[model samples]
Target: MDKNLIALIKILVKKSYITRTDLEVETNCSKRQITYRLEKINDLVEAKKLPPIEYGNQKEIIIKTETKNFLIEILRKSYNDKFYYFDKRERIIYLYIMLFMNLEYLSLQHFMSSLKVSRSTILNDLKDLKQELAKENIKISNSRSKGYYISGPELDIRGYMMKLVLLSLEDDHNSVVFDSIIDDYHLESFQFSKKTITELANKYKIHFVGDRLDEFIYIFIFLKARLKNHKNLTEEYLGKPNLDIISEMKEYKFTGELLSYYKDTTGFSEQEFHYITAWILAVSVGNFAEETEDKPIISEIVDRIMIRFEVLSGTHYNEGPEIFKQLYSHIRPAYYRLLFRLPIYNPLYPKIKEEYSELFLLVKETMKPLEGLFDGEIPEEEIAYLTMHFASIYSKKRDYEEVVKKNALVVCSNGIGLSAILYNELKEMFTDLNFYLPIDAVKFKDFDKPVDIIFTTEYQLHLIEQNIPIIKINPIINPRERYEIIRQVYTLLDLSVFKQPSLESIMEIIWKYATISNPTQLYSELLSFFSSSFKLKNEKKEKGYRLIDLISEDCMNLGIDAKDWEEAIRISGNSLVRKNKVTQDYVEKVVENLSPYFVITPLVALPHTRPEFGALSYSIGITVLNRPVEFGNNEKPVKYIFFLSSLDNKKHLPAMSDLLHLLNQKSFFEMLDGTKDKKAVLEYIRCYTSQSTISSSTME
Candidate 1:
């Protein structure tokens, strides 16, 4: 088979439906060549007695279920076979792994035998690998004495080795590449290393998220192999405080115990234990981290990253400490991943980049603080994951009066940000089903909660002995998979499916009666209008209140004689209680949450809690203090307090956005402090907000 065509075929097998443009762009082929390839695929399938693939009217590549399954089986089988087809790039990486692991002397015969290629082909691959290594200031040399040894900074060589292993695993999530590697290599320690990793996970109760267990096994199989050859790591990058913290972490103890079990095979050094502990913690989900707020290193890093986000995105967010704590949990693992150059594959990377392009770029730029821990450029995969967290935080809220038809469980083994992103997507797509997301895979099998259906990833439906129906969902789903999920879930639940109104038929009727003044534009507008209308009907939700709806002169107060910050919050929030916009419970929570650090700027502070605590509706009350009170630092006292209450996350963004901008101009603060009249302060704020054209466009 032609290599390019086979590659395209494999992609088609992975993604059942893709647009013609996307296919061409990914394959780097012309339209004419795509047509020829399609014809070639059809011929091959026809020879195999399978249905032919065709392009649908929507430019989607259409194939029958049987044909797709057949292609998948064939591809999987080829990866397992000894005579597996080795492309130029994979063959070179294959050579890298083999060279690193082989104890016996390497020769033309050895390379040819391992790759199942001709001697000349193996020689050419070696020449290419040498050239590529040279770019990293590494050299590959052959000597009769030390056969096929690579010479460079040993650290770079190990980093390259880890990068290759992760890259292979990323491409082949099924672990076929790793299976072949361990089986073919002459490394005697591979199986023992694999066994020790398995024991570590089971004995320590470490839940490696979503195929990460296999990744751990594969990474250490080579790592131990290198260590047995006495290629021990020589450098330590962390400072004393960080080293002390990691050594004190629970994962460090687990690493120590794991090394003890394998002490006969691998030396138990303090450096090796710390190095192993870092990577192990990097991969595990929800490792038992201390709830102590005093971890200054990770906490400071999270605060700095959030500050950067606020600067680059032009949004000020005061989400209490919960958001901070959640971000801290995520960044703790990420710090290690970057520190050790451990590659993470985000399957949702392309989708995140295309959908949240501006947010993604801003996040990438603002993540300079993260590189403080590492010397290398932060990977795009890591950035995209962070973007998802911010996207969830700053997602513009559209109110949908959602009705519950079925209680569905969304089982995603990826961490909180990814699971939250998936849940948001599902919520918009299927308004009828109430999704309780992000239940860990480790917990799903024994879950006692009532669930009508399950949508999961990476795990099969029938493997568990559950009676509830399941539909496997992809994080970055194609059109057909999306359609199948909706259709299957709805059908299983016996819910009435709403048919979309025929826009084309409606257009035909309009064409019969309407004038021909840019029918195309009219049709386009009508299609958009109808889709939005249909979407709204399905969602059945109300929009959130804006700043204008919540803030006015009636809620304004000035020159209040508050004794302290707690008193300031309650005094400013009097109108919210008088109007029944919030209960006393909400006000008390806000008062309790007030700290010197809660002050956004030296001049102003906006205080809030979760919507359910006491908020009955959207409201904002303002108080300009007569004397500055210490809501933040002692030097920077707060003169303004905006007590805000929202029904949910979406309703308060516009209000926050407006308030942030007004506080941005020092003149706004100066005017508020200058005026003792409540009406004057209210009028000035209204005038400033009236000219501002900010919509729900900001993210945290």
Candidate 2:
């Protein structure tokens, strides 16, 4: 059997069914040669006693699975340059088969039509493909109803490509184009006209030759552009071939010998030969297509191809090499027809053989299409924009906060009192400036906004449950430590700064705030000092206990309800007032990546915030639960909640040490869980305060 015939069969088997017409278009050969080749194919098949791969009913001829493996082995040998060198068509045919091995059913007539060829040419090639299959005991059959497909045991197809397809070009091509002859392969090709070409040449103020000079260069440019963008150009039929003859252009010259050499080297048909030679002339001169308008599109193509390949797939000159070749194969003829109308460059400079050679190699590498090759079809401008966008994203290392900033809303009560102060503070702090009101003057319904942060001095119980950052402060006559509050807000929002502080400084602050030894423990007491509700009437008349009575009476006077009080307790008691309280190991685990807190005191735990986080209020929430829960100190589980808070670089040492002394009592903790009365809790606190040694120490 003819080795080429065998190679063709393998291609068909792997590909399932490739139309004979495709072969004709690809080989640039006639129907007679293909048919004669097929008759020779059957004799070889008989000599080997292999089952016939060709079986045609009424509709079409098909290549089957059994024959496919045999053919692939032949391709493997050819691909390795072990046997004869294959032509461009054969190479494309083999690559297509190897690349899309799972292709089963194929429409023979439709495939032939796509190749723009006659039925006889297709039949002859199918004959050759089948004969080769027969030699390998593979069967190729066609049914009037079911069309074409392979049938047999599974074969290790992909493994074959991994071994053969990925083999180095040095091992196969040997740095020469015609060293391999792949006649059996069928690849799509197209062309353009001279009139369009000269138009482009005139517009660009370059030389335009009616000969093979300018045509070759134009094709090269088009191929390079299309390949980079991963775009396919279908032939646009414009009634007649738009041919323009530029008689004045004596700038570039070409010899018949050069044309003959090209024709002999690259197996181009008569028309294609003319087109290729003309394109080469265009390329010879420096009139390559360099449209600024096309740059964005080309760059976009490069970016997209890179992302798809997960590598730098193309260069800036054009999309890349692979796209060029595919275009060369399919659109060369269409290009010829459009050439007359195509605006071209003049005096096709001497062709740069080296440049073309480099381009050819790149095309070969890029031809192996993968899944993500063309998934994102971005506009040229958008792709250019994305370059800057992706750069910013990477430079800033923005994970999710950037998104929140663009969408979040900030709020503070009517821009006057503490709420206003907090509002301006946050507005200056957060880079993405957004906020809302904290006053009852605006209805709760009116407060509906995409709020992410809400800072308020006066607690409006109705607004507590709203979706936003609710930074509540004690209602005060005059808000001190406004700067401190602003700084804390900045840290919380992770504000963008003119000059970013060192990572050490940031981490130090974070660790100090997240740790149990900081001043966040005093939030409530700090709030109490600033709050002006102590002189209220109705609630103090009932409670008897001075502080609680005063607060309750003020709330009743303000028309707040019991439900509001319960909510206040939940929000203030456990959530806000309790500092970096490590209630459990899990809570400690959550903050472990940021800071190491609980190791300061063995039996005592002081929960607090770092001084940098503006502690506007010094408050404490003592939750002496019914049962003592295990805390950092294994020797004595925590019963006291010392909610500490502080201003920058200033820790209230005496108050902290006083609270620590109370917690140092064994009996106080022993009966801590037993007490249920509110009065009893207060009485315990009073007793603790009466003790001596009220100073703080920094010595660990």
Candidate 3:
């Protein structure tokens, strides 16, 4: 159980080989001590029924990877052994929990023995702990009788302890330090309280979003274990809600149910319900469990906050009342945290501050709503959490549409599992065009799919003739590859192809060379000139999509074999061109603009071009594919192509709405997907369109 032997086992577990001399050089163990401890390690591994540590013939320390790890966990968990890895922060936390428990006399030797660190390490930790606690005006007094003791107001001490635990929970690597608290104290009380809270939470349909509930429970148990020393929320350093206000809320009743069982053992007073209620409300999100209307005061604050945020961030919530509802839901918990002086740790605080520095500062400036409501300045951590809500609002205002888009094909080796995962990651990153399911690498050469870029895991793909850009990538792409893959895909695309003549560039050519006094008028005329296509595109969208009005019965083609999305577009548009509703130029224009965005709600393409592009009349062409064609621009493959030729935008909005309604019907898609008869598809659209448009109030 020597720390040195544990350290040696840790080394052996990490490395493939370590010689007797290497072990001595790495560790303080002597040659003889190394010989003896190897026997000890073998005995431990054998006792666990694992393969014994082997000293290889050439003097390498040969240990089974499993056996060495087993010994390390044993030393890690064993109460008798204090051989574990933790940082200075973790050490201070472990020490704080110890002193907070007030379990025994905790001297320097006791600290050294418990933490398995040296005396100097414990001394420095206590120094840092003191400095940290002093900010809250809390003191860690040490006496000869009691080695270390934490003294502060009950609420501050409890909050500080919980804040420490919450900060620890924010870390992904500090589970060892987190788990130590369970081993160190209150095993049964912690378990019982967790089970109780969990059962009640589930029964009430309450939920926790992330690690908030876990941290909340640990802090609760710590406070509950020391109930003999502390009473309910009587600390008057900060203001809390009056009795009538607390009793009026739904949490009061829920608190009664939660604390009724603990009343006898933990001796909960009347005020304790308010204290426990604040804790419960801070973490719970699901169903906002037992949510009632916010108090009038809090409601007004939420309103003011929303308006103030809109002004501060220069963003408008024009969508609906949904954003307001969400803002209130999030701010309710935030209000409780601020009002009760409850500190939370936003794990995203650093990233938010770094990435959203301007938004963070703006949100901080917009905290006037909570100004008179709370006594103290809101914690920066809380502000970061609040900033996220506003940042989402602000981000939604920007048009994130990618100007230059390309079709990316994912080709992976062997099984579809890894390839499927890679496909999803790419889908999330490139939202404008999430590729269809991944294809096999072997098919990459003969693949007739429409692809602008090929992403393959196989290295041999580079040697092949991928007339399209082929990016050879690893099966499991790391962060650098993820970034580089995106960069490479964008680099492969020729942006000039997508870039039209902008007003500014045109003006630069005109104004830079020729001076004009009527610049504003010239700018307007040039903007109108440049926007002719935009006007046509917008105008073309307003056609009434009644059954026979737009969906020409002569145009519906079912189950035709198409090579690619381009071919699919042409087949649908051919009927419209032949009917003189569109020109061949119109068909080609539709092909040029054939993006995945034209794809229907599910597996269909509805490609259209402007009236300026030879849309001679309003008509529709429908073609169904025997096989789905991957557009390389959407999650779904195109099964049916609907070519629309519009001569005007007038009344097109309602028609587009009707079209969306038709597209959403599952039976319509099913009929088209299966029916060989073109009449069946046209008849279904006819019946639905008649039923829908006949109900229009404007008809009255």
Candidate 4:
């Protein structure tokens, strides 16, 4: 008995006996070959004292499914060996003929058309097919008068094609070649699902070799079509946070309001969003979880989704229709969240249409028309304030609470020295606190003031009231204890926004380090100027006014140094002076993209740069405004200038905080508008800087 005969019998049993036509379609074996193989199979079974495979009245072959599966399993193992000898193309052609056996009325023209070949080619291929079949004891009964037919015992071929498809996926070269051929023509001319199988193979990165490429391509295409229509889908909660992949953000108790808010802000549909936004929020803290290190988990999840999709479609993995649908459903939403949270903006919003509405609206506001100029989206990414606005907003939400901060006033017996120390320390401990200190010592009756709390030592009790929230401590307080007192005051006042700085004295240390040039001259002159010129403006005494307006005139004078400074002091931004300083590390990247300092707008240029570049001088250059100039984008202008020149980024850190304190004053910008003389500008800065309510952008 021939090997082909044995193979046919095995396929029949393996598939529980498929139709003869279906067998040929799957195996590409000719009817003549199938018949010959069946004859040999019968002889072999009789010789072995085994029952022969049967054929039903319907003319379908019969084989035990279990036995066929076992044969296929063995054949698969053999296919792996390079030395395994079989003519794969010849096998397919042979099976094709067998599956359509005994159709004598189907002439040579019909056969040629069905096979998608020329008459001569078909004749020649048929000759080879017949010869192969003869070897297996099968015969094609044909005459010039009768055309052609086949006679044989049953032969099953479903298992043969199933095995072929599996083999094709295992060896990728075959699938690639098959895909190329199948894509060129519609195979209804050949009657097969070309795309379905090919798509599945591609998704799995499966490759094929030899002649099976066309079949694989057909399978893949079919799978793709089905995927597009959402014909098959299933879902499961895989769990929160696929730590294996950085792209997979951890799952949160996602609220619809949050989703709706996000949609309103970004314009992406809820179904299109992912948890990556949340992931970014987590990563910004600069620490990562141990589980996040695993990469294989991502690949595994992708695989599971792929396989599950196939199961739902009731098709072989590669041959299932709807492969693309599955792919989109499984990965795109997660990708959206990841990119939204990542450094790159590509892939998340590949186009303007994809951008969120809030982001777009914010950009529009930042680019609002100047007093005399029209506003529009600038093509330059750097010029845009979209990133800055969101960063600031995000920072506030993460670091500050919305609750109103508590106000505290510190009175001391040592006058300016103790008051300054307490004020600085408390501000460092509670950024949200509104702290104040009197310029001179006063009796307790004179110090009868309105304040949420009061902090003073035993010696200063003569100047402070016991009825107030008095936090009594040593005159020379521990820095840590002082911070705790501020914190306690904040708690008592129910201030949510009063978050302490990451480190106490951070700004102070930075200022000291940066103010290295002529510290004595700078400090002495600055202090003397403050004491003699500007008298304190009481916020409580000012009627129908914001706290900022009360101190604005004097604060502006101090900020704008006029008589001594040679050059006009302009705007100030972040900077870095020391290369080796760990504290100054944050300023490094900011300066890389932007001009270290920008002083290039009209009369109103903010003469400051990014802090990464060290400052050349350690001095404040103030220019008294003879006239106001629109300094910031046209909407915000400058009247008096306090040009900051730090030796390095670290030194200017204090001024940054100080500026924040000033800018956050509800009327700080408006107050600058009211300054009339150079003296007023200097007076305002000195008076405002001394007191705790630094109403600047930095403080906020």
- The lDDT per prediction is 0.68, 0.34, 0.62, 0.37
Order of the predicted models by TM-score, top scorer first: 1, 3, 4, 2
Which residue window of length 10 is worst by lDDT in model 3? 534-543
The best-first sequence of candidates by lDDT reads 1, 3, 4, 2
lDDT by residue for model 1 over 1-700, one digit each (tens)?
Answer: 4556667776676442355645766787777888888888788789999889878322456777778766666566666666557688788887887666545677777778877899889888899999988987678788887678776766577667777766666663545556666777644344676677767778767667665665677777777666776766665443523666778776777777766665444564677777778888788764326652226777778888886565434345767376676677678778778877666777778877765555676677668656755876898999998988877776544455566777878887677777666667677777767777567666776778789887665443232236566565655444434544554565567777756444445665676777768754765566456545444344543434445667767677777888877788888777788888889998887676554445555566777765767888788888888988777345567778877777654445455556656766889877877877766776776787678755433332
C-alpha TM-score for every candidate? 0.64, 0.17, 0.48, 0.21
lDDT for each residue of candidate 2 in 1-700, tens digit (9 for 90 to 100): 3555754443343222234543443455565765566556556555566554563211123433344334444445544454354443444333334222323345576446434446776566666655644543444566765454333211122112222322222122121211121222221121232343444545545433212222233333333222233222223212222122221122211322233322223333333323333344323222114342223433444444333221111112223454333222222222322242222221111111121222222222222232133232222222222222121111211122333352333333221222333333343334344444343323345755565445543233344335233344322212223323433344545565423332223334555668635333343344344332322222221111111211111111111122221232232234332344223232232223221132123333334433333344434444433333355323344334333333321123234434434545677666555655556656666666555533222110
Please give the RMSD of candidate 1 to the true structure.
Answer: 8.0
Which regions in candidate 4 have their CA more than 4 angstroms from the true location? 1-605, 609-616, 624-640, 666-672, 675-677, 693-700
Model 1 TM:
0.64
lDDT of 3 by residue, 1-700 (tens): 5655665665564333345645665676676887788888788778889998777322445555567557657544543335556667778888888777666677888888878889889999999999999998789988998778888776677778888887665532134565666676644355676788778877766555434556767776666656644544565633565555766656677677866666454466666667767777776552323446455555566677765554333234554376666566667677777777777765556755554455565566568446667776888887776666654443211233464366678886523333544565465455545364577554466767677766654433132334455566543333434434554454456533223443444565675579889755775565455444322122232223353567766777787998878788888888887788889998887787655546534576667756787887767677888888887565568887767766543323234445556666788778887888877777787788778733221000
User: Candidate 3 regions off by >4 Å?
Assistant: 1-86, 104-106, 109-113, 116-120, 144-147, 187-190, 231-233, 248-250, 260-266, 286-297, 396-428, 432-700
On TM-score, the stronger of 1 and 4 is 1
Evaluated against the true structure, the overall lDDT of model 4 is: 0.37
